[model samples]
Target chain A: MKDMIMSYSDLSSSIREPWHMLLFILLSSWTLLLCVAPPATWAESDKITIYSYSSETSINNFKLLKMEFDSYLSRFGPYELQPVKKREDFERYTKGRKDCLLLISSWHFGNIGQTYSLKPALVGLRNGKKYQKRILTGRGASANVEDAKTARIASAASDLHTKEALSEIFKGKDVADRADILTVPKDIDALMSVSLGMCQYALTTEGSLEDLKQVNPFLHRSIKVVAEGRKSLLLILAFPESSGKVRENMMKLVKIVQHMPLDPDGRKKIKMFGLDGWQPFDSSDKLTKGD
Target chain B: MKHLKLTWLFCFFLIVSSAFAANRMPKVLLINSDASVSKYGEVQEAFKEDIPHPVVGVNLGDEKWDMPSVENLLYDEYPDITYCIGSKAYHIASKYIGEKDIVFSSVLNWLRLPLTRKTYGVSNELHAEMQIMLFRYIFPDVRKVTMLYSKRYTQELFKNAKDKARNMGVEIAGEAVFKGRNTISAFDRLPADTDAFWLISDPEIISDKKGLSNILKRCEKRNLPFFSYHEAFVKLGAVLILSVDNPTIGRQAAGIAKRVLSGNKPAKNVEPPAGSHIILNMRKVKAYHLKYNENALGSVNSIVE
Candidate 1:
């Protein structure tokens, strides 16, 4: 409706005098129909509630995803997109809800899935593969996990996934107990802390470091990946146990998303989320092993 | 009834087709920070030729280029994007442009400038890593270099330089100077075994007229290799200067402008300057009895007699 209002000037400028009255009548009818009339085909459909665990500050990104879903799944039925900022908010939003879908991180999936009984539906793919966490250092520098012992390390250990990856690399030792950890905001900051000599080592993911290098060639020439950690699923679509009809609708939603036609706008929206497309969850074995 | 229905369908199709009519091309506004600077002209020329859209040029330093005039032009022209040539122009454009995409160049101390995701630029100076690499190329045998810089001007570069110098097997004995302090002793305390003296491009360190001559005399007496950031300093006996390729910077700005115009967000929100040339002083090479690397000599852009 907002898009229609914005295009009114273009519509008025291009329509000729002989057709102006007819164009006005058609536009008026269209607007009136949209405002007052609801399509009966969609009126009785259940709302497929999609939720994401992104913070309020990152609500705009989730809004873009919501917009994409609204455009693609209008045929499915009515849907509501909600971005839950806090863990407590998400917990509250998911309490006893069976028809809701979730976009959850791997860390949350492994750590909190048992209590929620969240069944994985689909996963986001970056070039048809999963991403892995990596430890980086200066080129030609030592590439040992033990090297982090005496050296200053840059990582956001506050993040559960980073802490888990550190535990994996350091033989189940807590990150806080091992080395000097500088908790910066983003992966780029951690990588740059190593590149700038503020720290001797940095811990980030493979895809993130690749993105940083692509942006800055100097970082590419100077920084090198020293250690690679376990592969982590980036984004997962999941749902709680629901009735057969609701669960079927959820599956249909997943299939629709997985097979979404990549029109230019659709492609742009997915690219905004740093994903190529959606795929079926193939990390069940890894998820079990991690558990 | 059939003819009336057909006419109604025709009117609806015409309205729908009108919505898809060709959109107005976004105009480009070129802003020059300083009228005296030659790089602005090169950027304007390159931008005019390279950008595939309507363009208008304005210099902030001009008498008629005040805020009101700029605001009026913005209202009249409605540029979708602005290409700012230098720091002053960038500051003005950034203040008034208001959410329009901007690609800026010829900016010194780009790190200090406030920028946005929509704002992108080509920095005026070479990356500190590259600068340190060039230093190693010219004086491979010199392991430790003395440096004088201000935290205000080059703190980030100094931090990057420490990492780069370590990788290149060089060490920097950095003396941090600032306003309202005794900075002379910092220069006097240069280690006896220091192999070279690097004069960073910060006015705070060399703004004192007497202090500049004193430092130069001391370097001459010590017979230390003096590296500088300005080519004019080479004529005054510094070894060489790392000069940014001004014309190349213009072209790089054009490339960024083109990308933004083509609806691609800048890959990097901030970019270090791309091209640099070594300006050498042949007399200083002879006076200091320095042996140059063959490859380094081959890469020199000009030699001052």
Candidate 2:
């Protein structure tokens, strides 16, 4: 019993042997590696990620949109659809990822497309139109742009983009900075806010207003368009300009999106983005270059 | 010929009376627990929008009203159906107008309410099935979750949630803490394999802000993701929050009210809240280094960076 347990000095002496010391160092290093390494599942892969950012689609629909889109894009290759909620996050994600593609609103593209070197490949067509207009709507007969200064403006656009769009519509009025903006999930919500008396004005697309007119004529009748913005392009599927493998992968994505409307499953997925189909982007087409 | 004409007039009178009864809109009385609470106001506003009937609203928290005054008002209005916003309003309405059909929302642990055949509700919290499914959707790898709850308040909830979670290929482990006991110690007894902590709305377990903060701190120390039932916890480091949309709950209650008023029986007496508002705390997610479904971002109503 006395010899069964080793003393601290004896244990230290036992580890002094050359092989014992080597084994201890090796074990320590292995433990350290295990501590510092990321889990095997989290390791980076070569799958091409497509970042989607659309102000038109409500955040609640992003998951369904991604699932449907992913199911369709799976046939093409190793493609992943990541829906980004914020415009800044979308831009940050696609900033340096040449192996990625972006499905973004043209309003967003016009703002940062040149900076990111994203060449628009296909333009989304909703109701067979390539361009859509933004309208500032208010309750009753209050349609003046100056009314927005004192009124709470409801918009589906991000606060930053809402200000920019409003600045363009208001033109020379510093109302954009002072106007109280309420960011809702969808254009319908923005319009409904005005109808519900939650907000005095709503910044929504002309298409959305028409949609409301069809669905809820009672509410639509209460809202009047105060101002309108120049025709802006719809959604754009753009690829970062790059050479070699990255460019080849991006071109494949372009082909997939262009052919999305042909397949039944593809059409279902494309419609989630609030579009009827996709059209080739012609450089000659006149569209609003967003500020 | 005179007898034939008299018979025809009697038949016409019967048809007209029945038609008038069918066309008569049921009177709806809205009882809000507190007019000062913005959420209650939102619910009332949304209810007004969808009801298609004129609604008389009363604030239970008003200084001018007492139990007897409220009772008198109920007797006077004699609403065909009562809509209650919170638990206090529900209790008062059920106590006074128990005979009439009642529709309630924003009440916590509605299963504890004295529900009857005439009672319908939109649950204040998301159902265990929907919540567990959401957890699976957002965190596919989180197979096991642990919760600390007071048996009195959450035992049935835990049992139901356990059953639903089991069906979804997830395990829910619970530790029953006595009322007024220190619930923080239960965290140490959690299983080693727990992938996340589920914060249920148990008043006995989380009695105050300090207790909630301590639990959250403990979760952070253990590097476990905490999923809460309220959005306020998101800013305090809850990784995910699933809450009922108040306005939608109002609309849902109105829907049920419409059914009851139109003499149509609802498919179910009590239904889960139809609209769920999800909030994701990105800071906590990153801090915990949690694995989350990036595609599930769209389901999130708000993200706290």
Best by DockQ: 2
Chain A TM-score by candidate, in order? 0.70, 0.80
Candidate 2 per-residue lDDT over residues A159-262, each given as its tens digit: 66788888888784477876666555567556755664546788988887876654445556778888888788998888888898768777877888888878
Clashes of each: 0, 0
lDDT of 1 by residue, B1-305 (tens): 99999999999999887775545566888888765667677556656754667778888878888888887887787677888888888887778775788888877667677788788877777667767766766656767888777888877667778777776677887777775154677777768578889887776788776877777888888888888888768756788787665654565566667667767655575665444556767688778877764334323555565
The candidate that achieves the highest lDDT relative to the unseen native structure? 2
TM-score of 1: 0.49
lDDT of 2 by residue, B41-124 (tens): 877887887687999989987988888889999999999999999999999989988999999988877888988889997778
List native contact recovery per candidate, as a fraction of 1. 0.00, 0.04
The native-contact fraction of candidate 1 is 0.00
Candidate 2 - CAPRI tier?
incorrect
